[model samples]
Target: MVPMRTIAHCDLLPDLIQQLLESNSDTHLIVCATRPEFLLHLTAAIRSQRADPDTAASHDLLTKTIGLLARSSKIRLAFCPTLESLRAYLAVLGANSNESTEEIRSRDRQLLSILDMVAMHVTTSEFSAQGLSRTLASAVEAAYSAGMDLRLYECTNALDPSSAVWGRKLWDMSVPSLNGSVRMRGDESTWGGRGVTVKRVAERWFEFDHSH
Candidate 1:
């Protein structure tokens, strides 16, 4: 099996998957958490660059090869930049309470770094919104004590885990707290509650569903 570091050959991803997953294969292929999703983005960029060699996008694409450069660079790092990527990594832990229902739950630590990176980019509007609570909460329930910095994000004032709205354990999100400030709150030791739902609620929103 060829170890294509960045998955640059987007078209070859299918074969790569087959080779890695086939029982008869003698080799293995490993990819970072973001590679699968980012591969789509990279493919688009490559296609755009190739479709019009004379276009300005083509000329600029030469130096702005996000996939080739960033994939290699980001994979080596610990954090992720977007909420989607963060959620995706967290989902990697397991669908429910991160109990390691399957072998996939073992990657919780790596998922933590993605949260840390997402928290850094998260804002008050996002933190307070009803959409992100469950996923953030699920991640909290996984290993709150170990991932304090990853759950709470502050755009202005410092995040207070004790008093922040997120601290209320507002699963239904019925509480209307005047303090718009957002912070990570809830039981951290175990993923006992409903935790984050892996189901897709919207393009970027994932709601918590206990059944999952």
Candidate 2:
């Protein structure tokens, strides 16, 4: 038989992404195989669903999970195929403007929880080229449009702009986010000493741009 990776690499990834976008929960997990990076996303999604962050293990798990979901391949989970449906769905996901900070935090976490499901898919995508595209970038765009200081996230993974899985739209959304007012602090706990992430994003982009 042909090697599974060769076969899977050829056919499985695209179909898996399609099913994930188009199918219901029962049908989503039925792929013949998937990319390892893709599997990491699925694992993160499932883990995020029941993750209890009171413990360090659970906290790291959910934070990593969110970071993975924040990557390029999975960012489309934030959107829908149709405009009317997307707007209605986003209205449901969004916190009310006048809501308290606690309410917004609670609601955003819940929204991220739901996003975990939509995001579990393969590394590669053509969603940006499609006319029906919806992406995490759209939300970032909306945040900027609303004058919100969209913040960069925490991650142990070196952000890879070169990776194929970090889909185009997500790459776009995440890159511009480096410019936000997310200053790093002296304490390692908060943003890590003067926006190291801003520097990382800039340097990564610089390297990627030059390397190309």
Candidate 3:
């Protein structure tokens, strides 16, 4: 079995990828770092690395590198970012894309897989009737469209009327399957006991059946 590789600096990503591609044996990579948010900074850094044609060339190179990672069978790559960092990254991704429809779809398909791998790490108490919650819900909806197997983490807040409306909102969502587990600091009965079968996975974490 190949040992999982871990790296600290974002500048090392391309080098790691090159090594993985060159290796004769299969491997799964897990690039651990104290500051996972550096990924967003890396994106910005790559863009500003040059101007005009050079910037465009670097952008294409970055895009192709990601595409290569996704397609390579010899190397399985995965990373888990905090919910906040993931949200920021997803927002950047959802922004205007100049690529073709096919290219966009292909990228989304690859992204959907990565999203699935990190779905459980997505913690949110933004279930309250707020614009931000709605924005996050919209992102979730888009992920569903891209064929993501989302296992969400709802950090239910007892004092907040979060689960009240959001539970109903989730129930009304049009998707093939909506399944998630909740990490509760307080009683989640305000929503969990409402026609949902809750199976305890661990302390404070309960898995709910597929709502759709």
Best by lDDT: 3
Candidate numbers, best lDDT first, in rank order:
3, 1, 2
The TM-score obtained by model 3 is 0.28
Residue-level lDDT of model 1, residues 182-212, one tens digit each, is 3336732223233232122111322222221
lDDT by residue (47-117, candidate 3, tens digit) is 44434565456443455666565557765544544455555544554453356555534542322222211
Residue 141 lDDT, candidate 2, scale 0-100: 39
- Please, what's the RMSD in Å of model 1? 16.9
Number of the top TM-score candidate? 3
Model 2 misplacement above 4 A: 1-87, 91-95, 99-126, 129-137, 144-148, 151-163, 166-212
Name the runs in model 3 displaced over 4 angstroms: 1-81, 102-111, 114-124, 127-212
Against the hidden true structure, what lDDT does model 3 obtain? 0.35
Ranking by TM-score: 3, 1, 2
The better candidate by lDDT, 1 or 3, is: 3
Q: List the residue pairs that clash in candidate 2.
A: 184-194, 184-195
TM-score-better candidate, 2 vs 3: 3
Pairs clashing within candidate 3? none
